[model samples]
Target: MGQHTILLAEDDPDHQALILRAIEETGIPCRIDVVENGSELIDYLFAPPQSDDREGGGTPELILLDLGMPEMDGFQVLQVLRRVRDDGRSVLAPVVILTASDNADHAREAYRLGANSYVPKPTGFAELTEAVARIVKYWLVTNHGPPADRSDPQYPGVQSI
Candidate 1:
């Protein structure tokens, strides 16, 4: 596989720009597909528009989800993704919660909803850079959940339900 593709689900344009810069700094050369909200993120993940694809690809390697977005929100998106990818047929990408929300409830709910990693979106650019780097390194490089970690119980991935 090439550099792990990161699907960054964020609504704000400025945040998107910052995220792009931070991710690039890691020399990962990620192909991040930014979505404004949860529904769009799901659409992109499941049945993306033809224009979104230069080559045929099924799913991404990682999902950097924003918990707070218009339409559906990250938690709901994760539920749906888990529902759809319940089978071990396809690769269920590791879903990491990346958000500005500092609510402890949100963090608790995120883990309960099957989030593999919960990363608070840092305020400082340097910290943001570090967060992005670590997120990518841990999920894509270090962590190796079962192929069906998100899907199959026996597959030992970051499973919630």
Candidate 2:
């Protein structure tokens, strides 16, 4: 009902523009943070909260990850995200692999590494728009996300339905 946040990890500038436009076409009120590579994404997600930084609100509701990135790649990012912290909790937000690669092996590996969904990047603007709309509506509107309090003893990380 309110504005949600999405973190997009995409290295290609062209792809970033396209994805941003597609998400805008959805007409959903959301804050999207774009990181050029997996390492930047990791920094954005793990950096200590700054009280004055409104853009860096907090953990995103969903993460749109591109498998091909400089420095750490999407799979490595997922590994770090899914790793259990000392407190026995992992990142609770769902990660969706939105990549240009249509290889089945990539999809399989992404799932194995804790990706919630693997979507091959649409070639056309219209298709990309539709796909982004559906993804945003489903994850930000229809889906019931994990609890926010990671420190809670009963809190379980994102789970598959």
Candidate 3:
């Protein structure tokens, strides 16, 4: 129906490229905006002064978050995201934990902190493509998320979606 925007929070440059390629292969008609660390990710979402000009607009429809990061980390981001959601801010996007971590404890905590899905990063390109395809299909095509408020003049981000 409309264009979708995905916010990806990843630290590694190589992993970032790979994930971007995988998502592109899915052909979901989405705009993928990236942030390198937890701090940048939070700033991007919350529009903290420096990140006020977020390229993808306001909040993304989906968030692909990496668990391990230099500052704030995925858990911390999740904590803030959940808090914003609870506060009824415009950040109702679903967060999907995309990580290399195979630790069950990490997954459990991610879920506990409000991650909608936990997808372990696949090592191979083919596996990564398949995983991204499935994720796109499920989240973009099958799932229903918050309705965009196109009427708001201040929120130009969701207008693209």
Candidate 4:
């Protein structure tokens, strides 16, 4: 199985349901852990919930983020995560912003703030399913996301980004 497990941080129950269903349809075997808010996403990623509650091996490979959450939104979580990485506390992970907002400015800000990709949430179920499947095939199968320091120099289209 691919080591790229997905961590989805979303608040909307209906949207979360649909996203989980789409992810399952993608046929990827990676675990998909769902969190209701961005704060929980941070806890699950960096700090285990509780030693007894979380016996998972390690952190997730990718984050499917929602920008507008209740208390701590995706951007705030991204900022904290970046800070942690900058401090050499942990390796950075790819964060893909998946939200209903179509604001171009928002997308630009997300990219500026360390988001690897900003995909507008598809409205229809079929389209969303295809998008999720394509995302899995690309990120989990084709693409490689790693920390900036250890990348091979010969790898084209790769950068410390």
Candidate 5:
């Protein structure tokens, strides 16, 4: 597959570094973008047309979102994304919540809010590396995502429902 884009919305700098290292270790050919807070993530995703960032950071194939964040928070981000998706503007990518919270209620609520997957934050670098490797293996390598090449008629464009 061609190089894909992955967006990670996380607050903790240390955790972000760890995840970035882990993703690099996975050796996936992807351009990973990092956002510090939910508001920044929103801006990254919904940048207005003609904005400078719009041309460069195209839609990510997958999103790794932290549930707890400053400003809007991940759940609120998900809610906004759901609404934006419903508006039929763009096909919102799959969002996976990578959080330290092990609360079942949070997981349930995340799923209710349209989180594609929820994973508890790893406690150590080894565990995080493993988690990120698995995520890359499954989502980036094994999974079949939307076809960006519009010339192929057999591949229907991904639609948000």
Candidate 6:
């Protein structure tokens, strides 16, 4: 199997380093693309295929989104993703809100905005590593994700009820 790709939208340099370390400790062969904020995340997702290290600018298997970001927050990014999915303009990959906030309202808002999962950022390094490992194992190894072909009805697109 090819290496799994993950897009991490985090602004804090320290947090980014910690998350990257955690992912690496999981021993999962993954291609991680880090974005500084929501705007950068959107650009990275929608940008044309560049002759870069990325795998042909394909959609990531999972998106680790931080709720608090500058120049368009995670919620705004989710809104754009939902619109794109609804318009059949993009493949809506599973989004996991990985934020420092344990606020119930934030979690609720994230879900209402179509986030597939909400994970509060763990306090300690060890705890963070464990959480990240479990997340990687579950989402990449165990989960049966929706079909990649957007035209397929089984493709899990965000739907507002």
Question: Candidate 6, residues 47-71: lDDT per residue as tens digits?
Answer: 5444565544555788999999999
Question: lDDT tens digits, residues 58-103, model 5?
Answer: 6678889999998889999989888776787556667889999989
Give candidate 2's whole-model lDDT.
0.79
Output the TM-score of candidate 6: 0.86
CA error at residue 126 for candidate 2, angstroms: 1.2
What TM-score should be assigned to candidate 3?
A: 0.86
Q: How many backbone clashes can be found in candidate 2?
A: 0
Clashes by residue pair, model 2: none
lDDT per residue for candidate 1 within 23-131, as digits (tens), equals 8888876788787899887666555355734343445678889988999999899788676667533446788898998789999989887788798999898898898
Candidate 5 off by > 4 Å: 49-55, 149-161
Worst-scoring 10-residue span by lDDT in model 5 = 152-161
When sorted by TM-score, best at the front, the candidate numbers are: 3, 6, 5, 2, 4, 1
Off by over 4 Å in 1: 48-55, 85-91, 145-161
TM-score of each: 0.81, 0.85, 0.86, 0.84, 0.85, 0.86
Which residue ranges in model 3 land beyond 4 Å of their true spot?
48-53, 151-161
- Model 6: which ten-residue window has the lowest total lDDT? 152-161
Query: What count of clashes does model 3 give?
Result: 0
Candidate 4 deviant stretches above 4 angstroms = 1-4, 55-57, 147-161
Candidate 1's C-alpha lDDT?
0.76
Give the number of the best model, judged by lDDT: 6
Candidate 3 lDDT over residue span 1-161, tens digit each: 47788889999999889888888887778888999899988766555344446553655778899999997799999898787767665546778999999889999999999999999988888898788778877988899977756565345322333
Model 6 ranges off by over 4 Å: 49-55, 149-161
> What is the Å distance of residue 118 in model 3 from its true position?
0.5
Q: lDDT (CA) for every model shown?
A: 0.76, 0.79, 0.80, 0.75, 0.79, 0.82
Question: Per-prediction RMSD in angstroms?
Answer: 5.6, 4.5, 3.5, 6.3, 4.3, 4.5
